[model samples]
Target chain A: MRITCPICGERDRREFYYVGDAVALERPDADAPPEAWHGYIHLRDNPCGVTRDLWYHEQGCAAWLVVTRNTATHEVLGVALASDEKGEAR
Target chain B: MVELAPKSPLAGLVPVTVGRMTLTEVDLGRLTSVAPYRGRDEGLSEALKAAHGIAAPEPGRVTGRVAARASGRDEACAIWFGQRMFLLAGADPDPALAQYAALSDQSDGWACARIQGRGATQVLARLTPIDLRPAAFRRGHTARTELQHMAASITRLGEDDYLILVFRALAGTLVQDVRQAMQGVAARGGG
Candidate 1:
């Protein structure tokens, strides 16, 4: 798979590391119940359709990216800087 | 006090001239890394310019003075490494930048090498994923990318000249890899 880094442009997927869902960026409340915190940290949706995920461009621009992709087809729907998510919708 | 000559990271291996390509070790003096505080990029740039007389380059760009003589002590090449981060080489960077940016002394942390000649681009293309095509990676373009799985910063100084910087610890490996790659390119007649 090819991921387009917002800073370095398109590059081979081998250069990046898959960091799981983008939701990981949102942390659970510190005052939440243990079970709620556990679910936030340990449990994740293994959806087969389009989903937003996080990728670390470890070998490129070193930017964290939010990649919208289809899990079933392995096709990338869109990509944006994780920092830019609040400013733009894919 | 007894003194010893400085040995390059690729000591005894570089200054290699094979066919139309040469991989030479260059000592880029006083390397410094500057990363602005959050939302302070513009401020950092202005400060750098006001103090050093050199403006910070934009992302994926490099700015440096072209000096005819190597003794020009103030010549500094600042290559953008990422968002709000730049790698500054050549002479002492303004220490005042520390107020607005995180400054790190990188003088001994990196090894600088220059690839130049007829087939220099082809040799580099074999090792890095960055596009070496002239039209795309034009002169003065800088990119931080992976070179054979090692993080590297590359700057195009000219059509056939490139400045490559890698971690000092990996300098030996980098030189060996580039030499082997250059041999392959030469064997193929600049393939």
Candidate 2:
């Protein structure tokens, strides 16, 4: 899989460090119970198909990216940093 | 019998390889200095020692922070390899019998770290453009970079000597590419 970071130019698949799912669930109120926090932290959907997730160019310019890739094939579909994708719907 | 084909553009280049040592990658959240440590010999042993404690020998790779030394008499730019203390020096590098010097020529003498003190030639065949001639990078001098796939800071410690720190994530594939380059060079020889 390949990711094109704005700063580091285009890099092969290895340069990026993968995070879990990109569309993280919204946080509940700060006063919410521990279960809510645990659910956010631990409980994750182990989907096998395509998933939009977070990836970081750790070796390059340190850019946070929201990349659309197929989990089965790891074929990157698209990439955009969280800040860049902020407020835009996928 | 088929006549042996001559070496192509890849002849004389050494492929640099790495052992899968989990290095502490810099937090990509912000711009941080990734320099590791720099010293003569004693100082290097103290700061850039093996993180996992396995003798930190040659043919291995380590990625540490790089920054200017706070107080020292040597260099300002440096990277920490396994156990050796390397300071980026002037330009030039000794490559394998093949072509490896084409990787970099601009910022060539950047001595960041010494991942593998000895047996550096075994892995250098993976990537690099400098030729690993014994006289060129003989135990001290540095290698000049021509091109790199990752955002890397490479230093040639000696003849067939190399120390490099590429981003951690690409670690796996970079090895594969280097191996391929080596194969290409070897094949040109007769593979």
List interface RMSDs for the candidates, in order.
1.3, 10.8
Q: What is candidate 2's lDDT per residue for B1-191, written digit by digit as tens?
A: 99997432222322343342111111111112222223233332333232211111221222222221211223223322211222222212222201211122323222123334233464464454444556444442232232245555454443433445444454555455555554554455421
Report the lDDT tens digits of candidate 2 across residue range A1-90.
Answer: 457655434566666788777656355569999998888677877889878788876654456788877778877778776767755655
- Highest DockQ against the true fold, candidate: 1
Chain A TM-score by candidate, in order? 0.85, 0.74
Per-residue lDDT over B1-191 for candidate 1, one digit per residue giving the tens place of the 0 to 100 score:
99998776767768878788888877777788898899787888888888766778887887765221122445676788876688777857777788889998988888888888888898888888777788889888888888887899888878878888899899888888988988999999983
Judge candidate 2 against the unseen true structure and give its global Cα lDDT, from 0 to 1.
0.43
As a whole number from 0 to 100, the lDDT of residue A58 in candidate 2 is: 60
Report the lDDT tens digits of candidate 1 across residue range A1-90: 788888888788878899998877776678989988888689898898999899988876788999999999999989988888844533
Task: Check candidate 1 and list the clashing pairs.
Answer: none
Worst 10 residues of 1 chain B by lDDT: B65-74
